[model samples]
Target: MVAPTTPGTTPTPTNDAPVADAAARLNRLADGYLVTAALHVAAELGVADVLDRGACDAERLAAEVGARPGPLSRVLRLLVAEGVLVEFPDGTFSLTPSGRLLRSDVPGSLRGVVRARGGVYATAAPALAEAVREGGVAFERARGEPFFEHLAQHPAELAAFQASMVDRSARAAADVLAVYDFGRFRRLVDVGGGFGVLLSAILTATSGVSGVLFDRAEVVASARVPEGTEVVAGDFFAGVPAGGDAYLLSWILHDWDDADARRILTRCREAMGPDGTLLVVDAMLPERAADGPAVIRLDVTMLLLATGCERTGREFGELFASAGFTLRRIVPTASPLGLVVLEAVPA
Candidate 1:
């Protein structure tokens, strides 16, 4: 039988019903585990990195990652559905632009995130129901400790977590650098900026901008931040580094409760210059769904995994207002992530 057609309108056959139906079935949310595991494995194995040199059969990639060809080929085919890779009739494969992101050395590499989800993030998924039930973080159910406490216990995992934020910042940085004029700012303090990825990205792009990366002592020690970065180890709850023209936090507030987040922003408010800018880089939990699913999934994941939850534009405005800073502007960046700018003017 032929697929149904509706006049000039294309009768787009939705769902798994084609020759590639078996794999498409796995790709759909019906088999969440299949896609989840496949993403982790492919990202971990550096399939994109390996294939970047040239296309070869599955056996070669498995050899590079120290795995078995039989199993790896099945994984590669899974990604092919998502456009991460492609297989031709001759039996070899190649990279698509989307797949290039998994390469560890790539500019916007998400290899760390890919590896992380299979580990901690995977564990956290099950806690979503618990968190929704209790109205608190479900990290304990996932890691048997609070998010920060777990980070303290597994130093390496925490380090990788920080690095992944930097990896993400590379993409957001390009947008920040392009849209915002940093020439007027003399100093920038990256409050809870993780491994200084956002700070490094912004500073590297803006000449004559000095930076202070404030975080826990352990996190600061682990960040292999690039040049001209001063590491200040302290809790954002206590106080941020002083004398900066700007204070920034990327994906930081979503890791804490509103009261704590407000307290942290208050510190930033106290530290800034009279006309300083405070920038927050992370997803703004939309009042209604955006045209995509990434942010929605990420917001829910934050609800399950951390003490924080993603916020809407108004939610951010309230947080900044409570912290004694005024919400200035909301700039949609080059990436899906948006930037929220709050200003501290003399009262």
Candidate 2:
């Protein structure tokens, strides 16, 4: 296979592998990225909404978006073949089931995700190798600044990132809740919970469960506090909200390394009542290190864009114990987001 020669590098067609394999990999990378860009543009143009009502040919759809049909047709054809759209014999196309994810109207949809990815995350993807060697996101190298700092400077991009996370939390939270039992806790705190979707889902599913959402000051400044939920502004690395019977960190730990994760966990441990529980909602890889590439690959993805890594259940057991939280149970969630509930007391 052709390897990227440098960070922020694209592997060009080369003589390393057999002609066909090299060509295929390079083509897949280049074409796939182009397709990613297409999805971004389609989501931005509200093409899914246009197609949601009915099918329209490229010319009409392009006209709706005030773009030329010739260029737009190429994108439509590529997406149709990719099952994002269904093409009719007459050349008009309609949205597919996957296309629903591109609509911003639906809860848990990927509209914001695709937009943010195509907008900002894509810029960081190519620099993945540098990030791997450097132990943090190559955002600085890629964009000349820290990720959150860049977000702070660009309000619109920050909004897009938060919206993307909020939408994505819905897509994964239901399956997550399905896999974990919320029967043990009365009140919970969501550290870095964007829009409190996961906490709301947990509370909505379990009776008499109230929750608190702690996030950045600006991020939570305008967040609507849903019924039975309180929203607060705080830093996770510094500390978190207090007085909850249980604490929850959903996909938050994966944004930081072991040290930062330990600090955050220590904060929660300090804040928890003697009987309080801590539920870490994350993707816990398998106990044995041999059977999976998905977990490790995603860890690599995190390394490329953030300073984090996915840990195995055994790793969690070790990490939890170190942070003064006991590993009580590792519950498997329905989706990739696994649930590992730890407690303040020893197991």
Candidate 3:
């Protein structure tokens, strides 16, 4: 039955339950920051690592991690609700399979990522609206310094950031090896290859292929590369290491906008021989939003953090053309990070 209304008045809805339900869902979506904060707290406290030994009540866990019992218990309950942990009948909580990834000592660990998200990235999130209204990088605007510059000043945060990259590259390296033939190249130069995770993996997989790991002096100072692999430190904008049949730009170009990306490509073009292959490992933004939700989300992160963007295949092609290279092929990788190897050759 419909409600009656005056001639000039709007009628009331017969059912408000669906509207209320939709509002509830929207509210949950808006509260996502709370989840991120909770995860960050857990990561900082090393909850997953402590629980790896055995399930324990929050009070004891709090004692181990130097947190308040009641508050930590509430946070643990929230994690259990979020499926990162499971509560036992006896009231102790245990890590779920997904929660195990938060352990700092484990392979594919995301503790560093959680810390980064909850720390440095979270600090920049509030400025997103301002950035949209006033054109500027959200992170720099919020922190009063560039992303890399800030990281350079904060060694602990830099380590967390680097660890996150290592985890991502470790996962992507296997997928890259599976899809691409690194054995074909005589010398492979990994430009801006932080920590040499991907470069070392390639050298191990491909025999007789010498490698050069290049990046900023500070970054390459602590890098661990395979035996006989040369490590050089320099600005990619100024120049890159030369004399390689293959120049690898793994996870680099997307950190800058088109103009800077083109400059990087130009440098790579100058550094390599006429027949050298340029392999760019990055996430290719899908034409449709629904097709690559993760990549789209990363694009937003890039907007918030740096003067960079994830681009579609057409954009990459255009950028390559501007830098005297032809887009040869984009080899898809099975990496969960949504990475693809964009192979190019000099024009």
Candidate 4:
């Protein structure tokens, strides 16, 4: 038996133990889909919600979740192995801290995200290799249509997608507010602001700032804008409404490829005045993938679902320059989503 590392060396020595550990990691990576499926099942069945009250026997949990006793017990046991659930000798299970995120009502609950993954992302997973090879969207490859077009036809999936965005936005909204000061701007326009979640939060936090929530007619119709805030429905590709001291494209640009993203920014630039600011709040990919795995994973998600690609700082600067704006600075935020505020000004 040899030690995996040499004393005071930078890199670990390639001993048998290190090789075995690496092999185990590869094995876990290969079987990652099993964990995803188990998590999706728990979320869909409301396992955490049921266990939120207290621990219960597998039989009781199975009955409550409308699953067969044996199968449900197996799922619970798997969850226990995954550290999402704790099983006692009495054959009962309870939610772990990680499992509580599956509860729909919690502050930062990921129930909607889990549901979305299970519903659409899982379907698109098989097309990833094809997407890499053919240079087309994976969701379209799997479903025979674009992701948004498919969502339009499926109301349930649309609802789940919207809910998932809301859940993600809840944290991002707070992060945007914490990092940026909106008080300097009299008028703030949120371009492609879905449901006005971040806009509302901004207006509430910074008094005396009016906002305009702009999106499609169907999306804006259901949005609840704060009092004194204006809601205008329109597409950013065609044109964005004019005359705002600050324009926000929160989590929007990352949904398109370079050409389409440039089109969107160009429209915003046309609407922006000489002194106006363009703030794009989204994940800015780090130089090293290991530095920010979540953001890199999000880029993969973009590849699967949309034409988007998460840009590095240099990439974003180029995008801004092409759209007739100068990239000013990248502001970091406290959100776990690894959000960054890209502040740009008219060139």
Candidate 5:
């Protein structure tokens, strides 16, 4: 009902629609954890893989995946609502296009990421409030151990983490190679390169570029590097391999704070010649929060999990200057991860 206004007086208009819409948005946001949990359950049960073979009823799916029929059906319905799955008229379930990403054998499989987020990352969620109140890592407070140490102790979680990294790096590599010219360098060293995914891609794409894959001793032990790649097992904090015209630190710096990142950059500086080039592939945080919501979310994840943080272009420049390097140029990539190649040269 609208109240009548006197002459020459403005009447107040009433519209509850915007308020209702805002409330609905907030409600959806608040319930996001439920979707995450459901996705985790489905991923762990290999529901998408099973459905890829063919659609099946909840009871059959439950029998195959060792889940209770009722709960599985509820989860399937939730996924259908979320557009990750589709429900047939015959009460069977099938994977939607988005749901196919959960399959373990797929090109961009997110099963590992799902396992990690739903398992270890979820474990640290409760400590986020405490971490905000007290300046410390949420994972360390929640699990009573550092992030990497926890991964070391838990092999399955470690494998999942590695798999996620591989999936992410594999996708980013194509985008990087498409934009950057690694063929200019004679020798390329990939420091802290896990499993040599990026190195493999570079070697495959560029001719006359010999690669050196360097990482921890344990990491390089099982590394499946390309043929002719020189595998070196050592700690980057102590030192990195020398003699390469270009050194690549792909998706590495974001796992450390400024001081630690500087230490790493210093090591690379020490190992490389004055003419050597350093290429750091990482997510460049946008200056404005609204412009880079995904990166901001990753920064929050870093706060929850480790001492690392995503950095802006200016921050990377400062870090480079502090480590005796001059910021050469930033090459933009078409990666969905918002990755950029920050090219630097020794001061």
Candidate 6:
């Protein structure tokens, strides 16, 4: 009979252990889509919110979420294994730390992101093969239109995407404000600023500085800003309002290809004073794939959603140089989205 190893001692390496571990990892990678689909279903059904009050058995959870007990229970069990939920001996489930993020009322809730990925982006994933074969957005290929055009046509989808952006930006804005000094600039123009949420947050953070929220006519028209901030409507590709000491392109440049990105930057350059600062807040990819899987994932999403791509610092530097701006420095932030504040100035 084989003897069991002591708790504190290392077990003798079996030749099969490493191979088994590798196979497990590979299997997990293969099954990743299942996790995403389950999370989407949970977010859509408000399962997290249902459990927010207290733990509940699968049958009760199903009743509250309007799902069948059998399937819902299985999904919940999967979530339990995934660490998003904790299953008790009595067969009741409660939220885990990660699970709390799905609640709508939470401070940094990712409910919007969950909905967007599952409902909108998931449907576009299969078209990625087509996108690679051709040279356009997979979303365009799947849905018969570009991402924004599709959003414009469908109000529900548009609302969900907007909400997702807000959810993403809300966390990022705080992280940005922590690292970047918005107080240094007098007049800051937020180009392509949606709903002025980030701008409002910035302005609130810095009392001395005023800001302009620039976006589409409809977007700016509905935007609510603090007293010192202004909401302006126009196409950024055409021109931006002049005389701002600082220009912000938050979560903007990643939506287009190099040509379009250059055009947008050119517009900013034209609008910017010689000494004006240009701050671009976007996801920056790391050199090592292991360092930034989330960024790489988003890059794939961009490949499918728009004619855009996430860039490295070198790529961004090249892009800025092409637009007659010299890259100053890329500031890192604490946001989980891996947002980098890229600062530049007109050449």
Provide the clashing-pair count of each candidate structure. Answer: 0, 0, 0, 0, 0, 0
- Per-residue accuracy of model 3 over 211-261 as CA lDDT, tens digit each: 999988878988999999999999999999889999999889889999999
Q: How accurate is candidate 1 locally (lDDT)?
A: 0.76
Error of 1 at 210 (Å): 1.5
Q: Weakest 10 consecutive residues, lDDT, candidate 6?
A: 1-10
Q: Against the hidden reference, what TM-scores do the models get?
A: 0.85, 0.86, 0.94, 0.91, 0.93, 0.89
Q: How should the candidates be ordered by lDDT, best one leading?
A: 3, 5, 6, 4, 2, 1
Clashing pairs in 6: none
- List ranges where model 1 is wrong by over 4 Å: 1-27, 273-275, 340-347
Answer with 1 or 2, whichever has the higher TM-score.
Answer: 2
Output the better candidate (3/4) by lDDT. Answer: 3
lDDT of 6: 0.89
lDDT of 6 by residue, 272-296 (tens): 8899999999999879878988998
Order candidates by TM-score, high to low: 3, 5, 4, 6, 2, 1
What residue pairs clash in candidate 2, if any at all?
Answer: none
Tell me, by TM-score, which candidate is best: 3
Model 1, span 1-347: residue lDDT tens: 23688799765646546537656766586777677788788876677777889998888778888899998899889888878888999888888887888888678788887777766677777776877787667777767788777887887678567666767777777877777777678888888877777777777777988888888888888776777689999888888889987887878888888988888888888887678888787777766776536778777777767768788888888888888877777877656654443343433
Q: Could you say which candidate leads in lDDT?
A: 3
Candidate that beats the other on lDDT, 1 or 3, i.e. the better one? 3
Report how far residue 177 has shifted in candidate 6, in Å. Answer: 1.2
